[model samples]
Target: MSLREIKPGNHGYLYVNSHPTGCRAVVDRMWQQAPEPAGDRPGPVALVIGSSAGYGLAATLVGLRAHRMRGLGIAFESAPTERRTAGAGWYRTARTAELAAEAGSDFTFINGDAFSDSVKEEALDRLAAGFGKVDVLVYSIAAPRRKDPLTGEIHRSAIRPLGTDYRAKTLVFKEGVPQIGELHLPVADEAEREATVQVLGGADWQLWIDALESRGLLADGFRTVALSYVGSDITSPIYRAGTIGAAKQDLEDTARAINTRLKGTGDAYTVVAGAAVTQASTAIPSIALYISMLHRIAGDAWQGTSDQAVALWDQLVGNAELELDDEGRIRLDGWEMDADLQAAVRTAWDRIDTDTLAASADTEWFREQVGQIYGWDVPGVDYEAAVETTVPWPGSPSTDA
Candidate 1:
């Protein structure tokens, strides 16, 4: 089916199946824009912690296609047992492994929890036996909750505003309406907040590094990166500047600590990626509305999660040293959160007096970009052709099932 026939709910599946082709295009564009990888040393081995979807998988594909790196992905989600299946991150890794096979590069997928000691040990063992050491380690896990393996206590994360009553205007994507609402920040007692900090913050990141280093699985002159985002002040109380914001602050600090640990070898950095609409981003209370409006105002042809991932890969993975401000965090999201940009968007939003918010907010470029992310607006591809095909999961346990 053409991308148009696939409704909003199933769009993510379609994107994953088509991502290999999309990633190829991204790689071609990156090579055209930037210089090639520095050395001919056997293509670097990379391990992507959250390699199922979003930026994690994008970084994996970018390393493969643009930098010619061999990769292994570790995802907590279940793998697909059937062809043309739509499990999260399934199609991405499948497609990536398929292409890697075609190019004679190694690719592996491990379905397990990234925080567990056993899983980390397995990953390290595999890397040591196969590739000796990994040159790149990308931590991109974004789970809503995590169960403490030892205590059996489940910790859930909240995206609501914390400690302050904040009023905000947001968009309803389904109804295509703009409405104002007050965000009731959660009143988490001290323990809950501390738990939130422990679960969502950077402790797991540090743990992963410790596990790898203890096992001596890091390559010399290795690079490691983690992804973070700081959204607009409008959503700050709920996002970066709020409870999750506190988590991110811890994450940034962890990045610095990790960088210190990796100092003699090479570099460890955190990428404060720009905000685009992702499954994780959309679920936040006021963010969907913000993204919808931000999409309209920025007018730089806003793309979906896949496109954002591709752009991130091009800028951060394919090229080293992001455009960082004096604060040391990369500033891709800065433009989106720019004071003037947010102010103008807010002004335009206030003027949206009627329910024709979709029409009022719609821009030709934004629509076109969203279309492209779903494989709609791209040129030279026959939309009518039967492009639907099974996702080939390389090295799956049994093809029969």
Candidate 2:
């Protein structure tokens, strides 16, 4: 092993390497902060579909450490290579397995393409052999593309408006300085629009549920949630009212369809989550700028992905009751979308520019949060010293994936 100073490979959405130490530290903090279990009976067995990073990983921690549930996490991640470490999610899953082991909670992780029918079958087989039945399933997959299992066609998702061009203030870095810059996202074409829906929409989610249900893997009163986002006015033109929005609407529709198919044996919901710094969120236009402002306005009170995941579990499984909006979807973004908060964010958004970006938003904090996603800005990690570049993904049978 040699000392490696990993940095952002691009505008900051992608990184060259991930630090195992920092990743473990971040997971440890989330596990420590998660609320204790609310029920005296044994917790539910859960299968978190995207449980490696972001909300999926947080939900895994919530289930294993908070609710004391047995969990099986499925994610697609790059394993450690000769010249580079594994992706941040890989390290996170390995560490999560360790934490689960310490707590005597059963946790299994599979790293593979979740959209593949073979992978779904593998997950189902694992569920049958180990978990027996799943009471909870969290669909939190975010990908730029997907390969259709039935047709063998690859569908790629795009971040673009529907009919009209979208111009917005997006976060950009000039010579390593965070700046508010204008982004002009053109409307996606017909084929691109359909492709976006194919990749990001509810089709894959429905497939997973159907596979599990067909195998008699879903326990009675089974509950599943697909994480989603609906942006504010400043971002709606490029986000909520864009191609992504259409896909999210499909996701909600799929939830209703699943409910109908289950015939009260289970429930499905599309959970609208608050904006957080995730790999997918960073790539979206205007999200970085908006999230920076959210961080600024809610300093010390800002709820990160882990906090949001905990709150979600509390409502979904803890003592709290499940609250739904008019559309029957869980609206966990309510706190982030408070009238006063959005007003403050809009005021900052209006004034933000390269000159006033730092003052209008917590640019440094935003950058740090992004760095922490790949285990860079985490506190007390000795980045200067040589660290292992090939951290083993504990007990993962699909490490080669």
Candidate 3:
């Protein structure tokens, strides 16, 4: 199928071939922009759980390219089977291997669910045999559903509010300009809230680390962090104060527990990121509105996955020291909440309607970023040409001519 011709599913999720050039653009920029570290001593061996796209992809890129480190990227990405190709994550993983090879870096991509105990064991086995122990384990897995490897229970995340329904100005992506519309959200019940926490919270992160530690896969001086987010007051009803927020609170609690449990080895952190349109963010209620308003206020400063990854990774490695909040969490949401910027965005947000939305928020940029998540809307890519779906995985036989 032609890349541009591929349509999104009913839920607005599109599956496309990941753009190699666009992926390279992100890495190249990160390589050039990040400060050159002193000494020939490079960073540590890392393992990124959700290591195909978004922050996980960015973290793997930094480890292999910028940090001059070996890494194992484990992601539950499907291979290109039959006529249809796998989603963009698979392509992104393939491209990461290519980039790593060119840079003479040791990198591996494992295709399996990070939430599964069997998959975790496989990763552990690989890490034990190949790298001994990882210095940093970045748990960046974001999934809609998680089947508890032990209990055989399935958990799904919810993004609705707790008490009442939420109605807000939201963006509807279309042919050209995004149409602004009012979206009504439902309220999540107790069961839904618990389910979201189980899937999206830090329990899995803690479990992964515990498994690693029990098997002695985590090296001394090893650190771990699972990404979290806390947006401004505007979207709290659906995000920070919703079912998802409850999960994050659990995640943050797990971070503290890890800190206490693994005193000598290292500490676990819950790094709170900003409100940006992501695969995960799509599930959040009114994300379109929140992200649009944020972009309006913060503009270029709204931290995307790449720069945010760099910042978090820098903190993880102790290269950069940030003043963490009271809960000992790293806050890297960018300038969206800045007083002056907040002041500037209110005028537009207050008067925002279908007509004024185009004028208020950078909907073009918003859509571009959202599309880039699925390997669409990227510049300098020939979408009309056929994209080779299968690519070499690590040291596997070449799928190319």
TM-score (all chains, Cα) for each model: 0.78, 0.95, 0.91
Indicate which candidate wins on lDDT.
2
Model 3 Cα lDDT, one tens digit per residue, 1-401: 22233333333433344454454444455455444445557558888889876677777877776676776889887666545556667767766787778877777878888888888888888888887878988888788889988799999887788899888777776655477778787888999999999998887898888898888877888888788888767778888888888988999999989988998668788878766677777656567766777787675676766677778777877779964888888888756667777666666667888887767777777767767776666777666655555555556676655
* Deviating ranges (above 4 Å) for candidate 2: 1-14, 38-40, 396-401
**Cand. 2 TM to true fold:** 0.95
Q: For each candidate, what is the lDDT?
A: 0.63, 0.85, 0.74
RMSD to truth, every model: 5.0, 2.4, 2.8
Who wins the TM-score comparison? 2
Shift of residue 24 alpha carbon in model 1, Å: 12
Distance from true position, residue 374, model 2, in Å?
A: 0.4
Candidate 1: minimum summed lDDT over ten consecutive residues — where?
A: 1-10
- Stretches of candidate 1 above 4 Å error? 1-41, 80-85, 149-152, 173-185, 301-322, 363-392
Q: How well does candidate 3 match the true structure, expressed as C-alpha RMSD?
A: 2.8
Q: Residue 107 in model 1: shift from native, Å?
A: 2.2
Give the 10-residue window scoring lowest on summed lDDT in candidate 3: 1-10
Model 3: residues >4 Å from true position, as ranges? Answer: 1-38, 174-177, 399-401
lDDT of 2 by residue, 1-401 (tens): 34355543545545777887888888988898887765566778898989998899888998887888885899899978767778989888888999999987887888899999888988899889988999999999889999999999999998899989988888888778887788887888988889988988999999999898889998988999999998688888888889999889889999999999999998999999988998788888788889988888977767878788887898777467787899998888877888988898888888777888878888788788888888888998877666665666778344332
Candidate 3 or 1, higher lDDT: 3
